[model samples]
Target: MTVTDSATTALSQGWCALSLLHGRIETHIERALQGGHDLSVREYSLLDVLSRQHSGVGGHLRMQQVAESVVLSQSATTRLVSRLEDRGLLNRYICDTDRRGIYTDVSEAGLALLAAARPTNDAALREALDEAARDPKLAPLVAAVENTHHDGRA
Candidate 1:
């Protein structure tokens, strides 16, 4: 027998719905960034975070810090940074205070790429959000997602 929305179930519909929504948004952002800018959403996020590190004198972040900020595993973050470095988009260096710690700062090229891609990325997100808001059924889901982000729980 097949179960439908009217049937009793053990699964949480809310969680499943949110997970699907997240997947769709992720795909949308990934495609928009990659197709238009030749950059992945993860790469854009990394560059964006590095560019915002004004608290650091040289606008750098430790590799660990970058991993945490970008929600990438340490090894994955290292590889991604290496890829960006190879593209001349960023520079990796050893921290002055901690010889074993590595840090990365966005290069001029990285900043320019991010600047160029920002509009495309922003437009895609705005369009997705606007569409969600227009759908009465999806509006609450979008609101919940926005609230989590604003509350720093995202």
Candidate 2:
């Protein structure tokens, strides 16, 4: 094969591998959600973010921050937060310092849902990690995907 052809083939293979890995992770998360958790992966992600924020000094996360962290658009994040709020799982408060800013806090009900969903989330993640760890070549790929944009600078 020519050098150009070889490079193209390698790139195509990499794309295929990444797609397959993404599909597997999506399936695992879907299973976790459907196994009586009643929470979509996005919802679980939002809840997880809120939980960690509450553990920090502020006890809340701005909507934009949550959107960025979860890879959702601003409108999508607002809708997701609305759904959670409707379920009494979260509370939205306008920022006192920034009038245009909105912050979300996990409600008691939200915390309860997260607590109930923790086992399933933990098990799914552990299973995915363990399987990936079995293949040394896959571990770095997984880590890279997980930390794609997680540098200290933002």
Candidate 3:
């Protein structure tokens, strides 16, 4: 293969490995969360994110921000929020100052569920990463993931 072609092939392979790693991890976590807490990965993620909000300035997240954090479209995030709300795991309120803005927070039940599910998620993630690390094609990606900081500074 030509130099350019070789480079493209390598990049594509790297992308595929990353995608596979993410899929496996998510699936593992999904099973664990669902079986243990009746929560999907997305639902657990949404609850976890909303649980971190505070009343201070810049503490509340907007719908778009929540969607971005959960890696879902805004509409999907809203629907997820609604589901949780129906389950008594979340509460949505219209912003007092800005009638156009809406805010969501985890209810007491959601916090309790999140607390219980956190360990399940973490263990599933660790198991998935360990399994992925055993695969030659995914080892490097797994290492990269494990070494990365939350701020993206490795």
Which of candidates 1 and 3 reaches a greater lDDT? 3
How well is each residue in 1-154 modelled by candidate 1, as lDDT tens digits?
Answer: 4676435343465666667676767778899999998999899999999899864475667777889999999999999999999999998778777799777889999999999999998888867776766766567888987789899995
By lDDT, who's the top model here?
3
Candidate with top TM-score is: 3
Ranking by lDDT: 3, 1, 2
Error of 1 at 136 (Å): 4.9
Q: What is the C-alpha lDDT of each candidate?
A: 0.84, 0.81, 0.94
Q: Which runs in model 1 stand beyond 4 Å of their true positions?
A: 1-11, 55-60, 134-137, 146-154
What is model 3's C-alpha RMSD?
Answer: 1.6
How many residue pairs clash per model?
0, 0, 0
Models, CA RMSD each: 4.3, 4.3, 1.6
Off by over 4 Å in 3: 149-154
TM-score of each: 0.80, 0.76, 0.95
Worst ten-residue run, lDDT, model 1? 5-14
Question: Rank order by TM-score, top first?
Answer: 3, 1, 2
Error of 3 at 7 (Å): 0.7
